[model samples]
Target: MTAVGAAAEIDTYMLAMPSPDSPVVLPQWISRGNTHPNSRYQDPIWSMAPLIDNPGTGLVKLHWKNCPGPLLDQVKLAAWTMINGQLRPTYLQTRGVQARSRSGGTDMLATCHEWMRLARWLHERQITSLAACAETEWRAYANERLSQVSRDTAAIICVRLANLWAFDQLSARPSGIARPPWEAEGVDDFLPAVGTAGGGENATEPLDPRVLGPLLIWAIRFIDDFADDILAAWAERRRMVAVAAAAKAAPAGWAALEEWLLPMARAGHPLPANSGKSEIQVATTYIAALTGSNRGQVSRFVKQYGLAEIAAERPGPCPLRVPVTGRINGEPWREHVDFNEAAELMKHLGTAATIILLYLTGMRPQEVQGLRSGCCPDPAPTADGTDGRRLIHSHHYKNVTDDDGNHISAGEVRQVPWVAITPVVHAIRVLERMVPEGELLLSTAHHEFHSRHGHAGALKKHTLTLRIESFVNWVNREAGVQGLSDQTIPEDPQGAIGLGRFRRSLAWHIARRPGGLIALAIQYGHMRTVLDARTSSSYGARGRGGIHAILDVETALAAADTAARLRDRVAAGENVSGPAARRALTAAAHTPRFEGRIVPRTFARKASTFLARDGIVLYDNPDAFLICAFKHDNALCEPEPGATAPRQYDCRPGCGNTVRTDTHAHQLRERADELDQFAAHAPGPVSKRLHANASRLRETADTHDATAHSAEALT
Candidate 1:
């Protein structure tokens, strides 16, 4: 802890922590290939009953399976917790969750694989720990990767790089700028793209190694996170199914009830990492229900069960069962052995319902998990034109803005009107058929999964990824399909899919498919840019005087068409912009002005940046350029899910809009020549500042036309 003066100290610290004999162990290699404990517990076929429906009666069983930690997983979880001690609650509903606070007697220190990697990064950069910073506190917009987490999560991979470089804890930092330490190449990744025409030195100053330690830990954490993402995805779905089955089950005796509740809730149990407290509570409540008790009387019985040791300390196979009456719509929602394949989905009604809800509403898992029985529309405000359609309202929302663009308080309602999709409808139908009979659309006996970290029905950020992963796996297994890609990115360096992919996929479909939401929503305020027009924004934005609706029907169609083509182009190794070249140019020529100019449209350039921004584009493709490559000379956005290498794209004069000229023309692909004239021909003061930090940029079509073009070349 004393400024990490030597390598031996790290060994000393590890030794001081959990001994090898401890039940909790951090192994030598932190890679995904590392071995973990396989669960030894297996329920008799008869014990395999649903837990939620009969919480008060059925037995509570668990098999503690080996759970691996991913670097990013640790970062996200740790970063949030580190920022304000905000551990989420377990959703037992019978009571709220509270953590024992301490001054400093027991503090935790977590970092990436080695202290040196972190030390180098931290020692070289000047980053103010967002753990204690604020949005308004930023006086200048520096370009360091600045993230403030609500949970104690951090990306150990990127963040750790900064911690080991420099240790200037007390030096003044540039406003808004931040940095991770230099990489193995001995170069910092998050700096202003230098010498580009318009780039600036985004780093305010170099950070001391000690000050940058937090970042190194955060980045490596992400690396580890992605590595373990696949396994975690599988475990998550299994957990959800169990928890859901438990929520509606009948309560059991005190012994069973105590087994269900104590781990995540009562004093002796430490909340399991990754698993939310709410989900656990939901499972326990249902487990108790199966044990033969009701929610009201379950608490005392649980305490007794705790005294008796009925609650298994680990996780594993159990008989997930339900009473005959527990059948959802006269069919077992969890087990339907009597039903044929067609009737089986009647069992997966929950999974399908969840997937549908998430995709349609675009709400994070936390929002859905926090949904309550009464969290419906007021019917007071005249239902907007979108009334009959399924709407998403975030009631009791925290850390998010409402539909009206208002910030919501913790436990406040925030609703988002969702465009219903076929899947969403399917999910609703399933939910209608499987409604718990006693609570909200999504409910639990104690609402444990929903309240994973802290409260009666608490939800956390990871809940989204966890639930989505579960749904996706079920979809893959149940659909009996392979090679199907939704919006998710690939998880394996060689694999091809993930969760965030859904949103992007949705956007891609909407942007590329003429019939998708962004296109259709235009008539109803899902706007797009029209060069020089008063209505230049999309979806909706408040302008100088009026709340202008900038969405359009034609442009939507064009963009959607282009988005679909982009997929083929991506597959064919072409830039996303190349596929939509003429269309983007046309749209660019007609910039619409709502309250102000909509964003500058960089079709090919955007594709390059996006590819670089996300690892979807092959690293070796010379054309791949960070979207901000032109925006900032030095900064490289983090790659998207599924990417492993950190190489640039295949370069071409017209590949994308930006590239790094500092190293070589081929260092990155650029779409510079394709940028709209407004930017390409922008006054020197503007254009100069834009790419100056970058070493150079490709010549625009106009420049080519003026210099070397025949009339045909000009065209």
Candidate 2:
């Protein structure tokens, strides 16, 4: 029937039939109770809460009440159809648009928003239905929308509108255009510039070094150093609460108060003062909780005995005596953690563990949230009698599909587990102590410290985001007290810290580091060979989220930056000499300028090609005081056969690829001078060895001065 004919009998045709007449039917793949479909399409709201297994996916309700009155039924019909995979053949026939399966909860919500936008636009123009709207009106809406949002975002809205044309026969209002939004042109025209058929570059910015370095330093410290104090304090808090609850049930009165105070008095231990304050103040409520007396009764007893004045004379009480093991600059980070702050500290500790996991494991935030207490078990032995590394098992939701390529709400277990490093394992162990085994490590239920307070479920992303910011603020606040002001994580120019940025930043660091695994080996205690052999390539390929693409972008950028720096140093009259110095100069001069440009996947492909040029690939090693013009054949650092990059961390002396500049000579002599100063303070035989090493360094400097020639003269 035509849309106009459908509108006449809309109530009879569109409204859901009685439950007995039309029993609830679900898609075969949708494991019955995983999603709830509203029987009546006339309902103001349709909740897909069960469909959202991951809280990180955000909201899942479609608010039909929010749409304009004229197109409400049309919007509902389109959304319902999309969720049920009921798209008409006409919509599937549209060029460059193909969606065969049911929409996921998150995608359904986005489609609803698109419908609302189109509905409001139509209503504002006094157009009641899609049948009356023409190509002219659609173009006007698209142009106005393109100005407000990005071309890609605008394209999504355009695609949604085009789908309506296919659903015209089903919708009572028939709100859609007959032709595509951009006539004779495809939706691909609005996408970001790319050279290949691959996806767009990752837009998530890696955390700036100024922010990431200190952030990680403090996060590791929280896991390694402060964890003991925090966990102990938490246990003490729980113990105290339990004792208080027992006393409340069986009121022991003033006799209990005397019994509690007498022991501390005999030991000459000060009363547990109000830990919330900076100065000592007898905690009457704390005393009452311990003694089972009212606060007034405890206050009366303290006044009669002059306990407040006596407490002033004695050192402040350390109720738990949880020693301050975490230090800064060779001293304890804090003298003591107070009982009042323990609950707050536990929350921050969870945030710290989260940061360590996200930054080190390269797991997405939701995957980290999905992690249970026993996610990482002890390392097992392989069949070959070798020790296997620890692995974390978790579920990934985004882009998770079944064998038929249809999106499924019930996320599957990752076939290849994430390899866990020491820091990640430490963080997991710390979290395991906080939450019960088999419970989510970051579950909101465990965060409250008290069983009655929080809702039981995965902690939401916005909540985690706030916790991250609070953790940063806590670090900065403690910096002054610890006298480590330089170690404070500065405010990111990219705005507040987030969990999403860690993966991108990790990929950047791993790909940009001198050796692919050198940074991981030092910071996380995992060898490069193990990660590469086990899961490195598959980790990037599994999701196809452009992690490998991101790595290539960073690698290319690093290479380009190194080449640019080399070119600048040569032009500034620095002398350069080595086996491949001339080749280095030539490549540096011709290297493409990529600074400040949006690096597309095409650039990534070109970057792979750029890195493949072996004999001339320049790897700057500041620690070694030289540049490596890496050649697979001549490399003494023992790169695997056919490897394009050099093992820069294992730079061997006398390698033909090593290039020494005027700066390297200066640094060598400077090092020799420092060693001479150390030699003067050493014992007899030790002093002689120091002097010999210093002399050797000076000789190397002299050799460089003799052989090095200016870049202008060499070319």
Candidate 3:
């Protein structure tokens, strides 16, 4: 055919009607709420906004504008094959295929981009048509992509390319890349599988301990102490906004403005100032809040009364008299929280609450973001009449499969709700106050619900991540004011904090901190043993799958780290004293170093088996100033029948499983001295209790000094 004739034929083919048997009719909207389809089959851009439910999925339009004009028809046709598979399954029979699951709007956008890449490469070489591209050239393109990206990405690229041949019958202009590469085998033959685990492994790096400690400390401070002030500020701001908005229609006169200013005058307070310019100017927004006046009324009142001069004479911060209840280092963290400062502080409060929920509950960021108001209702009393644990009710999209093992696009509500720790419950309560009932917990529309975009879904993951870092920066900047210079969160060596890292970090800490440090327990506001038991019970749940695997891996890895530390202490000529000291030495000599390396699911299984081996299970108990060489039979801490691990939290004074090194003895003595210092300044009864605890710690250290023997001699 002539070039002009071929071009005319291609344009005719591009505008061809959808299959007669297709589910959707012509010029129909593909997505929900899309009354009008943005494009016909031949349009360069396909709007996918209506096809997607969540804006966070990204890229609501597919731009075929970048493809060479000649190849555009072919690329659009290939996309239709996939789109037909997703949206019109009956049409696929024309291509000699059964109903096949295909990409949704987001994935379709990606697939379209993949096709454009091939088109760009072909256009670069001055190849105008798909049919003109040979099999060799196709293989070269696929191979080039495979080398540049991950196996998973390579697989996606190859599959999209293969589909051109696989569904050639559906297209008018078939490609000369006629057959699927690798003959009898497929892309899997050459490319390795992406992930090794059937049950997913957590690859997200946990926050460094230096970062986790102070970050959590500040998060708790915000929730526990700062919440009242922040929430109050928010309520006050809302009232002021409502009043001002109403006042826009019904303006306040000078008489009413004078009445509003009477209280400030009686209290001998200056007018609230605006720092918009370099000068101390009267703030119209504050005036509007005080007098139920609009901005125009406030402006007129300020000029008439010469309040700008008064504001300049008495310029400082807002004097709204909101109490500063939150304290740090036994002193008030702030003297006052002003309206403008409070407005800024509320966002940080939200971020801090997010940190508390994500870092403690082991909930994925999406799950936390998905939470709606009243998702975690107040706990009802148990059947046994004890206080029931709070549970978070939400839907999880990841790995939600149908009865036939096919993934569910819209996730179902989790059958088992996650047990909410106290901090998590508090965080939820605080979030509940931010948004209306039944709204998403972290909705971006919290402050601007009446805007054009109503209830703009949950804050995006990247936005939350930035807010978390901002919270850190804000804390660092204000640490000096709060007398927390030493407690400022250190920079994480792992780089920027991410939402995914919080769940993994929670697993790492819970698995490692088995000793039930008072700080850890208090941070959670629950018994450590109960937390361990309840959280583990939820392992293998339908919604939450990998957390159990993560916990097991972390436990084994923490043991390995503990053993390595023990070996170093022993090699440095430290003496060991305990009935299990020999077993500790043996385990230290044999246990492989983990060093926080990535472990596959198979390694997680092996880690479970390693933990089951009784007497050598070394648990580093930093809070107790000892190591626990756990053996179920010899344990002083009560163990359930057939249990493989000891309850480190319930350690008995004379437990045979206890091991004490010189380092542990030193820590014990140090703790005793610190207790003595505090006791010297404590009240009479409190001083007696502190002194007694110090005596006990000292006695334990003295006992270690007298009975400790060289680890080398024992071996």
**Tens digit per residue, CA lDDT, model 1, 444-506:** 332242323322222233443454445445544532332323322223331222333333233
In the range 611-642, model 3's lDDT, one tens digit per residue, is: 78889878887778888898888887776665
Ranking by lDDT: 3, 2, 1
Top candidate on TM-score is 2
Steric collisions counted per model: 260, 1, 2
Give the alpha carbon lDDT tens digit for every residue of 1-715 in model 2. Answer: 7555555465422322123222222344256645444344555667665455664565457777778987776666666655543454444555443354445677767777876887888899898876666868776777676566655566666666665655444444344545654645766654444332222434567788788888887888888888998898888767766555555323466788678785786688866776334666676655666667767777777888888776767735535556778876678777888776788889899988998888877777878888888889997789998877788888776677665445766566776677777888999999999888898898787886534554546777888899899989999998876778888889989887777888878766664554433234364213322333323434423533334456556656777787888888877888887777887888788777665645543566776678778776677766567788878888897765555566666778788887877877899888889888998999989889989988887887787888888887878
**Alpha carbon lDDT at 71, candidate 1:** 23
lDDT of 3 at 477: 88
- Candidates 1 and 2 compared by TM-score, better number: 2
Model 3 scores a TM of: 0.81
Per-model TM-score, in order, reads: 0.31, 0.82, 0.81
Report every candidate's CA lDDT: 0.30, 0.69, 0.70
Candidate 2 least-lDDT 10 residues = 16-25
After TM-score superposition, the amount by which residue 443's alpha carbon in candidate 1 deviates from its true location, in angstroms, is 5.4
